[model samples]
Target: MLNLVLFGPPGAGKGTQSEKLINKYNLVHLSTGDLLRSQIAAGTELGLQAKSLMDKGILVPDEVVIGMIDTKLNENPSAAGFIFDGFPRTVRQAEALDTLLGQHNTGITVMVALVVDQEELTKRLLLRGQTSGRADDQNEELIRRRVQEYNEKTTPVASYYEQQGKYVAIDGIGEIDQIFGLICQKVEAAQSLES
Candidate 1:
C-alpha cells in the first residue's frame, strides 16, 4: 500500500497532479471536497451540516469530515492505496488521520506538498475563476482568505509529516507536466524506501 497526502495551498495543482498520480499508481482518490459535495447531494445529516458551514465560507468540522473518510476507507477494502486531498487541514486532523490509518495497520507513505507563492496562487486562481465560474474564485478577497487560512492552519501539518520523515516539497511553478514529474519522482523514491 502506498497511501499519500497531496498537500498544498489553494490553486497549487493538487487536483491536476492527483489525477495523473491515480492513473499511474492505481490509487483511489479521496478528495474531501468531493466527498462533502456527495454527502450534500445525498442530503445526509453530515452533508447538511457541512453545507451550512461551506455556504458561510467556513470549513466543516473535522470529525464530520473524518467520519466521511472512515466511510470511504471502509468502502474500499482492496484499494492499492489512496491519495488524500484537502482533508487534514490542522495538526489535530493530521493526528486523527494517523490514528484512523493505524486502525487499518497502514499509515501515510508521504505528504507531497506543492510550494507556490501567495501572489502566484492568487493569479492562477483568478484566471481559473474566469473559466471555472466558481463564485469564491471570482472574489480576490476570498482567494486571499483561502490562502491565508491554509498558511495559518495547514502549513503545520507539513511539519508534522516532516517530523516523521515523510514530507517532500515540490516547486509548483512552470509547466504542469514538469511539476507532475517531480511529484512522481518523490512518490517513487518514497515507495522504494518503503520496499
Candidate 2:
C-alpha cells in the first residue's frame, strides 16, 4: 500500500493537492480537520468534544483525534491506501499512528512536507478566510497562533519521518499544478525506493 502523509502549514495548499492526488492515484484522502468537521456537523460525541476545545483555541486531545482516525481506518480496511492530511500534528499523535498502523502490519511509506514562507502562508490564509468564511482563517491572530502551534508542536513530526528515511520536502509556491508535480515526483521516487 502507498500510505502517505501530506504535511504543511495551513494555507500551504495541502488540501488542494491531496484532493488532486486522490483523484489521480486512487488514494483515500483522510484529512483530520475534515473528519472533525464532519463529526461536529453530525453532532457525534467526538465532534462535541473537539468543538469545545477548538472554540477555546486549544487543540483537541491526541487521544480523541486518534480514536477518530482509528475508526476511519477500520471502516476503510480495503482501501488501496490513504493520504493523511492535517494529521499527526504532534509527536505523540505520530507515535500513536505508528502503533495503530503497525497493528495492521502497515507503515507510512512517505511523508511529503510542503515548504512555504511564513509571509506567503499568512497571505494565502487571509485570502482563504475571505472566500471560505472560516472563522479561524478570518482572524490574523488565530492564524498566527495556528502557524506558531504548527511550528512548535507539529513540525517535529517531519523530522521523525526523516529519521526513518521517509521524508520528502517540496516547494509549496507557484501554481497548484506545478507544486503537485513536484509532489508526484517525490512520491514516485519513494515508491521506487520501496520497490
Candidate 3:
C-alpha cells in the first residue's frame, strides 16, 4: 500500500492537493477533520464533545481521533492506499499510527508537508472563511491559535518522519498545479524506493 500523510497547518492547501492525489493514486481519503465534522453534523455525543473543543481551537483528545481512524482502516481492508489528512497531529499520535498500521502489515510511505508562512496561512484561511462557512476559519484570533497549536504540537511530526527518512517538504506558495507536481515527484520517488 502507498499510504501517505499529507501534513500542513490549516489552509495550507492540503484539502485541494489531497483531492488531486486521491484521484491520481486511487487512495482512500482518511481526513480526520471531515470525519469529526460528519460526527458533529450527526449530533453524536462524540461530535458534541469534539465541537466544543474545536470551537476553542483545541485538538480533540488523541484516543477519540485514533478510534475514528482505526474504524476507517478496518472499513477499507483492500484499499489501494490511504491519504491521511488532518491527523497524527502529535508525535504520540504518529507513534500510535505506526503501531496501528503495523498491525495491518503496512506503514506510512511518506509525509509530504506543505510549508507555508503563518501570515499567508492566515490570509488564505480568512479568504476561505468567506466561502467555506466554517466558523473556525472566520475569526483571525482563532485561526492564529489553530496555527500556533499546530506549530507547538504538530511540527515535531516532521522530525519523527524525517528520522525515518520519509519526510518531504514542498513550498506551498505557488500555483496549485506546480505545488502538486512537486508533491507527485516526491511521492513517485518514494514509491520507487519502496519497490
Candidate 4:
C-alpha cells in the first residue's frame, strides 16, 4: 500500500494537490473536512454535533473523527492506498491513526508537507474565500487563527512522521504543475524507500 498524508496549513493547496495525486496514484482520497461537510449536509449525528464547532473554527472531537475514518477504511478494503487530508491534527491524533492502520497491518508511507509562508497562505485563502462559499475562509481573522492553530496543534504531526523518517517538505510557492511534480518526486522517493 502507498498510503500518504498530504500535509499543509490551510490554503497550501492540499485539496488541489490531493486531486492530482489521487489521479496518478489511484489512491483513496479521505479528506476529513469533506467527510464532515458531507455529514453536515446530510444531517448525520456527527455532522450535527460538529457544525457548531467547525463554524467556530474548532476541530471536532478526535473520537468522532476517528469513527468516521474507521468507517472510511472499512468501506475501501481493496484500495491501492489512501491520501489523508485534513486529519491527524494533533500528535495524539497521529498516534491514533498509527494504531488504526497498524490494526490493519498498514502504515503511513509519508507525510509530504507543502511549506508556504503565512502571507501566501492568507492571500490564497482570501482569494479562495470568494468562490469557496466556506464561511471559515471568508474571515481573515479565522484564517489566521486556523493557520495559527495548525502551527501550534498540527505541526507536531510532521515531527511524528519525521521521527519515523517519513516526512518530506516541498516548497509550495510556485506553479501548480511544478509543485505537483515536486510532490510526485517525493512520493516516488518515499515509496522506493518503503519497498
Candidate 3 lDDT, 90-183, residue by residue in tens: 9999999999999989999999999999999999999999998999999999999999999999888999999999999999999999999999
In candidate 4 the C-alpha lDDT for residue 1 amounts to 98
Best-to-worst order by TM-score is: 3, 4, 2, 1
Candidate 1 lDDT tens digits, 1-195: 999999998899989999999999999999998899888889988889888877666888899888889988999999999999987899999999999999988999999999999999999999999998877788898889888988999878988999999999999888999999999999999999888
Tell me which of candidates 3 and 4 scores higher on lDDT.
3
TM-scores of all candidate predictions against the true structure = 0.95, 0.96, 0.99, 0.98
Error of 2 at 21 (Å): 0.9
The top-ranked prediction according to lDDT is 3
Q: For model 2, what is the C-alpha lDDT against the true structure?
A: 0.88
For model 4, residues 12-72, the per-residue Cα lDDT tens digits are 9999999999999999999999999999999988888899898888899998888889999
lDDT of 3 at 114: 97
What Cα-based lDDT does every candidate model obtain? 0.91, 0.88, 0.96, 0.93
Report the lDDT of model 4 for residue 152.
Answer: 94
